[model samples]
Target: MQAEGRAPGVREVAAAAGVSRQTVSRVLNDHASIRPETRARVLAAMEELDFRPNRAARMLTTARSRTIGVLASSASSLFGPASSIDAVEDAAREVGYAVTVAHAASLEPFDLGAALDHLRAQAVEGVVVIAPQQRVQDAMAHLALTVPSVTLHGAGDAADEGVFVDQLRGARLATRHLLERGHRRIAHLAGPGDWSEARARREGFLAEMEAAGADAVVSREGDWTAASGAEIGAELVADASITAVFASNDQLALGVLHAARLAGRDVPGDLAVVGFDDIPEAAFFAPPLTTVRQEFAELGRRCVARLVALIEGGDLAFEEPVAPVLVVRESS
Candidate 1:
């Protein structure tokens, strides 16, 4: 039994398990040659004693930090980026790696470089860049990285490290949903121009409209805020010919809903709306929003897995771009 108010250690665990210190070490490291019964005994003893191997000691001996660095933008509070960070942390925990985050104040090259310097000081084994803006990507392209890295947003090129969602495909799915419902004249409330996601979504909407030979009204651009959406929505509702609207994100859709109500327009009857991101608040809106759902959980898992592969010098398996799904609701 452990002494009162004292934490248990490996020596006590080995003694309780009737094994040598070397055997306990082998068990902790998951040595393939250890007998199953011996491993089970060591684990049982560890559980009984509440013993945890010292991560710092392990790093010192193995010369591996077992940590991942997340380089994020100041917009980490936003739903998409916040969820991505959470998912990355969960996936890394599952793989026995800790995560350290560094937030850049802006997309400026100096800010990004400072953030990278912070992560480097932590001795992170790999990096996951979570900023979705094009300028950030361009800045990172020029920076020299000493460790392997993966990005959550990009064109999924070889340089992107095979970690991305198909934003264009998701946008097409949202646009097609409105089109199939007989909305010929549609408008798009796009996000900020600097965001790669916004550009892809706008392009997808255009492509889908052209393919269907429908009127594609490229409406005003918004800042991915409900206020911008509402401002754009007021103008959009002015044109009664525009029967449906596809927004770059759910927040914009919410703004549109608000504007439609103020204008006495009936959703689905006078106007249909589709959104992207499928944020949590999207479902509880006055009329539940019909939106495209980005598979953020899968994206995080893939990012960590790809980073791990790069760090370990393993085969880089080419994965297909993460697909998005259309969620139907009363709003559309």
Candidate 2:
């Protein structure tokens, strides 16, 4: 797929489809009078030339772009962000809206601001933010926002805005599962401090630990990577008092499992391990894994529905809360 030259415009699309410019325009705008055969021809031409209709140009007359822009902190390979993004796209398409994603080059404020500006330049009617960092949320509050927007997160709180997946409840569930198994001195392998999800999860863990009157073994700061977890776990092994672990994510739990093995500790015997975010491969991990599962698809759909409602001037307080489930497995 190499570029021939400048992108094909409406004229080129019309010529390729062997239709009049008016016919091509009608097809692009989804006019009620356009014939199905002609519309198919135009769509085929668009596919062949990789042509995309310019929403900004069309908005000149209708003042409606029928598009939503997404501002993500970064396009990380993490499953939670990736899955939620996919769900948002699917849900937006179902409601006849196109999605435009602008991912920050980094998690820095400068990159986030640049990504927001780029999305704004596209003239999107509304925007959805998928960045869950506290700093990003702070940045959003200061901006004199001119567009209706929604943000999806895992903070586990009912707010005046945003859709959350109840990270606190999930963390408590994970911690309780360990406690029920008669394990004491439970350890918490937390994620990055700046992330709202990480903070919420740690809060839940600490609360549960204190509630149970158990000594808390909080690990060092983690970056939500297996390598970081392994590094932290290596240190955690030296603590003979710690008997259970709840990692903020599955990857970290996997590292803890490895660390336990190296130290000749048996899972569910010497140490019970649990994780959050029941990723697909969790079931197949060496001894399986106990995890907390958030409804990412429902979270995504609700986010789009909320943002669209905001754009359409309908009910902005629908308040569809997404709950998390605890999946019990062998490791715990």
- How accurate locally, in lDDT, is each candidate? 0.90, 0.85
lDDT of 1: 0.90
- Give TM-scores for every candidate, taking all chains together and pairing residue i with residue i: 0.96, 0.82
Clashing pairs in 2: none
Q: What TM-score would you give candidate 2 relative to the actual structure? A: 0.82
lDDT of 1 at 21: 90
Q: Candidate 1: where is the Cα deviation over 4 Å? A: 1-4
Candidate 1 residue-wise lDDT, 63-175, digit = tens = 88899999998778888899999999999999989999999988799999999999999899999998788889889989999998888878556665547778899989988
| Predicted structure with the largest lDDT when compared to the true one | 1
Model 1: colliding residue pairs: none
Q: Point out where model 2 deviates above 4 Å.
A: 1-61, 157-162, 318-320
Locate the minimum summed-lDDT window of 10 residues in model 1: 155-164
